[model samples]
Target: MSGAGSVGNDVDIDIGALFASLRRNWRFILVGALALAALVLLFCLLSTPEYRAETRVLIETRESIFTRPNGETAADRPVLDQEGVKSQVEVLTSADLLKKVGAKLDLAATDEFGKPSLLSRGLIALGLKRDPSQIAGDENMLREMREHLQVYNVPDSRVIVVQFSSEDPALAAKASNAIADEYITLQRAAKLQSNDDATDWLEPEIADLSKRVKESEAKVANYRASSDLLVGQNDSTLATQQLSEISSELSRVRANRAASEAKAASIRRALETGAPLDTLPDVVSSGLMQRLRERQIQLNTDIADLSTSLLDGHPRIKALRSQLADLNQQVRGEGRKILKSFENEASVARLRETELTRELNGMKAQAARAGGKAVELRALEREAAAQRELLQTYLTRYREAASRTDHNYLPVDARVFSRADTPAEPYFPKTLPIVGATFVAGLLLLSIFVLLRELFSGRAMRPIDGVAQAPANEIQMPAADETAQPVPGRAIAEERAAAGTEYPARPPASAETIQQIYDSYTTIGDDVPENPHSVHAIASRLIETGISRGLVVSPEGDDGSAASVHLARELADRKLRSILIDMTGTGAISRTMLDGKTVAGITDLLASEKQFTDVIHSDHYSDAHVMPLGLADPERAMRAIDRLPIIFDALEAAYDFVIVECGPSNAESVKRLTSATTQIILSVVDPDDNAVALSALDLDENGFEDVIILTGAESSTPTPPSGDENPNPRPAL
Candidate 1:
């Protein structure tokens, strides 16, 4: 018979027992592993060997500099990206290309691709699989080829790998290489067909473009002629050129008229003022005026000489004077003639300017009319130029297409770089790995089965020491004492059950475990207070130092617990929110503060029997809150006692001071509740007691340098007021 032991409803598993079980069954495990390895090896030896062969093809633009289009360079060759390479991989395995390869290799004549297997035929007959025979002959061959053929692009490269598997090594290599060769052939065939189509399409397009070119040019010529938009110098219209020339001539003629008029006016001024004719530039430039002036000078010289030598009325002197007078008259007459000639020149210049201005105006009007017509002419020219450009482009393309068609020089975008070679070894049924993996797997599986059998038979289980065994379905509540409180959820369930409503039961908590944990804490039974004045001092220190949380160690049991209550009440009196947690085994703090009311507390929370809200109760006689010792198994609650610091943290956040009264504890016993910020207080009726000194020394050794020894009155209740008329006497403090 098998027997199992459980502690708190958990089965205890023994590692030593499991190892012993494996030791006793080693022969069986070894035999099973060897049998599995032998079977795998035999299967490997009997399986048909499949030879795999591979061929590699590089996909890229194959055009050389000389064979490329007119304007294309070597750098302009299209390189395939990964997607393009993958597209070429699909092309390599295309149905049409594979069919060609299959026919070329005569794969349909071989047993591999010739007929369906007997099993496959049977399955097809039963409608369990599709029938290959129902497909066409070419499709059947293609389908068979697809199963054996593998095409994929190499990672991050334009190289595609084509592989084929067959029983015959030579056939594998032949089929792989044949597929690559046929793929290239198909690429070239496609290019050739495309070129032929382009040639056929371009013939009509070129002819139409040629006709358009001729018609557009004729329209340009006709428009130019009809609009009379004849181009002259610098490609400008004839009317514009004539207008420019006439305007220049008019400006020159007007300038000449102004110059002549100024000159004629100056000569007339000289004549009327009787100024010297030689001083006038126009008069001095005249030949007749200059001669007359010369003659007058000569005659004046002769008269002066004759008057000095002969009488005033001598014949020689008389002749000289008469000639001088005649010369003077001739000078005056010559000046008038020169002035009149200048006037006539001015009139001629004015007449020429008027004629030229009239011609310029006529030319401008003709040019303006031609400008409007020239806009239409320019539109025709642009259309003709565009058509001519399009025609030239078509002619170039048609010539290139025709040349290619005649030469049959279409090049494929890909080429076979490495031909497939026959594999020397079979590609599948690796003997060593198969046998080794089977052996390891079988050994592991058999070992697990043995362990499970041992565990299920209860031979691998042992009783866990110091763990209380209890029934899973039964819940044992802590025995009722002066401060033992009922679980909140259980109390609610009891009430609801009494009212004819059922509530779901909570999980069971072991009561024996909780009581053992509580009873295990050592307590001092002396309850007499030693120093009453020290309680006020401790409270004042706690308030002044702003201590939010502390661990209270009581060496004198209820007396020390009563001091903690007094300290909490004193802090409350000082307007600080204070809460006291009773962690003593005797429940002294809860008994004094709770006023005989039963409420769930920290132990219930730790045991998962009640929530925090259901565990905290208010003090009856003071403003402080109190947490009682709960009715949960202390052993199970101690399992979760590590959560005490978290509870202190939550109380510290809500209250100004959180004080936990530990009845009798050393440093190690309360280590979880202590931190750097937590103050340690030793509460004793006698400050000099051996136990009190030992507790303080223990806390000091555990890194708590500040231990406050508080001694106060034994009675937790405060004194009543003296006045009978006072309506509200002070409550317990």
Candidate 2:
């Protein structure tokens, strides 16, 4: 059995076992450590010693210190320094370079790493070392030579390291230095070959490109001279700009000429219709018309004066009227002169517009010829531009290539900055470090083995230690002031009895004292939890993990029912369909606390008197429900639910949470419920007596998985049920 001993709501860890595990297995640990040390020492002693020698090569990215460094980038430094260094390292360890070194040193003729001891040969034959090539010659030795050489770059630096190892110290140093020297020579040879190749290919290509560039430029000049398409400041020809200006001016002149003609025509219409000549602005503003209008006004005044003072047949009055008529004729004559002037001006504007239109048409023809020539000139110019760019590129590359050839530039990226010295001691077979590491490894393994063994050991396999054990002197009896209330299902049995139906004759259950339980509800202003937060936390975990249903139990079974009811109520507050089921076979406490009677419960449902629908009752708080244990013949009811898995499954499926207040100290009920559930909470009468309480639980015998403790809050205590009377029962309806 796996026991989780809890304090409050947290399970206590047995830290003592971790320390005890090491104590009990100290001898085994000592023996293992000693054995590992011995093996390391033996291996170190037998291992062959070899000397290592290294040489450092400075990888010059742009220029060497001997040559004054400049801000200008090297002509050949296209790649980054890191990449260049990596390439040099690969070149130094290349197979071709190793083959040259092997031939020069006559490595195949010499006897080094050629014959191995039986143990080494066995390890090699087992393919620990790669199988050597079958071909027997300098090629095979060249491959072996590569294995002895190591090349790498120093961190954050352009310097490369060339290392070699051998039984002979002098040979190791000599080989390392020789490889570095050979790499430099190879770099020089490669650069010289590249410069030679570039010069040979580019010499003829550049000559041809230069000739083509001259030809393209000549053609561009000749085409420009032939085509009269002169380039303006904005790439447009002057003719194009001139033509656009003329076209806009001609449009404006034509518009002015049309307006003048229209005005003159309007004046002519007025003269023909004998409309008032004063209506025309030309006529009204004329000096002659204004003078005539003044004279007419004077004549009319004279004629009126003469008529008021003399007889109607006066010759002087008639003469003055004749003078007024003559003045009016003069005003009409002036109006005619102004109209004639407007007609002549309009006729001149029409002739000027005709001349401009003729000139504009000719200019358009000239622009059309120039435009065609410009298209051909542009195509020729594009080809010339392309040729010029290519020629410039060729000249630059050719000059650079030629300069390198003349200077005999050594294009090596790295030069040897330091040479390797013969090593005094072997770099391998570190005895002390090997021994220490092996000992530590053995100790680690031994600790794990001992701990696992102790974990499954009989003494550590104790049942849960959180069982609530009341003090020996003070038994957890029911509350003194409260006795049992009416049994909920007692009335259902009575109704059956009155109706002449056969009934279970068992004594009615004593109802429970329930104020303490009801007060546990936080809604009523009392929180009866040692840690309300922890209760909610645990409830959330249970709900999250799909436990949903479990029994709350105690060793003495005194306050377990009260605790169970409180937990169910808290779960209901979280909006879960949490309900309490008094599987105590006595709904006495339930009826008293709920202040309600069970109409028909599990017994009636099982007996076919009522269905499950008729038995479920809503509690006072939220939507939480309660299902009481109704009265039935004890023997038949127990037998009917002997396979209680079905009944518990149905109840769990029906509610989000089904809290079983299993009658106290019932291990069988706990086992049955836990098997069908994922969580089990154990309530305690006295939290201080944890160890004694845990021992009383006998969890190993019960076989429960998880058990949480609801402790230190004895404020909500349960009372004993005193009544044997049957409570009221309603019909199935």
Scored by TM-score, the top model is 1
Runs of candidate 1 with Cα error greater than 4 angstroms are: 1-31, 74-80, 117-137, 244-361, 440-733
Candidate 1: residue 570 lDDT (0-100):
73
Which ten residues in a row are the worst by lDDT in model 1?
521-530
Per-residue lDDT tens digits of candidate 1, residues 598-714?
A: 578888989999988888887776788888888888899999988998888888888999989898888888877876567788877666668877887888889877788777543
lDDT of 2 by residue, 627-725 (tens): 777766556666666545666678788788887766554556566555545466766544555642663466655765456766423233232223543
Residue 211, model 2: lDDT of 93
Candidate number achieving the greatest lDDT relative to the actual structure: 1
Error of 1 at 629 (Å): 42
| Model 1 vs. true fold: TM | 0.51
Q: Cα RMSD (Å) per model?
A: 19.9, 19.1
Worst 10 contiguous positions by lDDT, candidate 2: 724-733
Q: Give model 2's TM-score versus the native structure.
A: 0.46
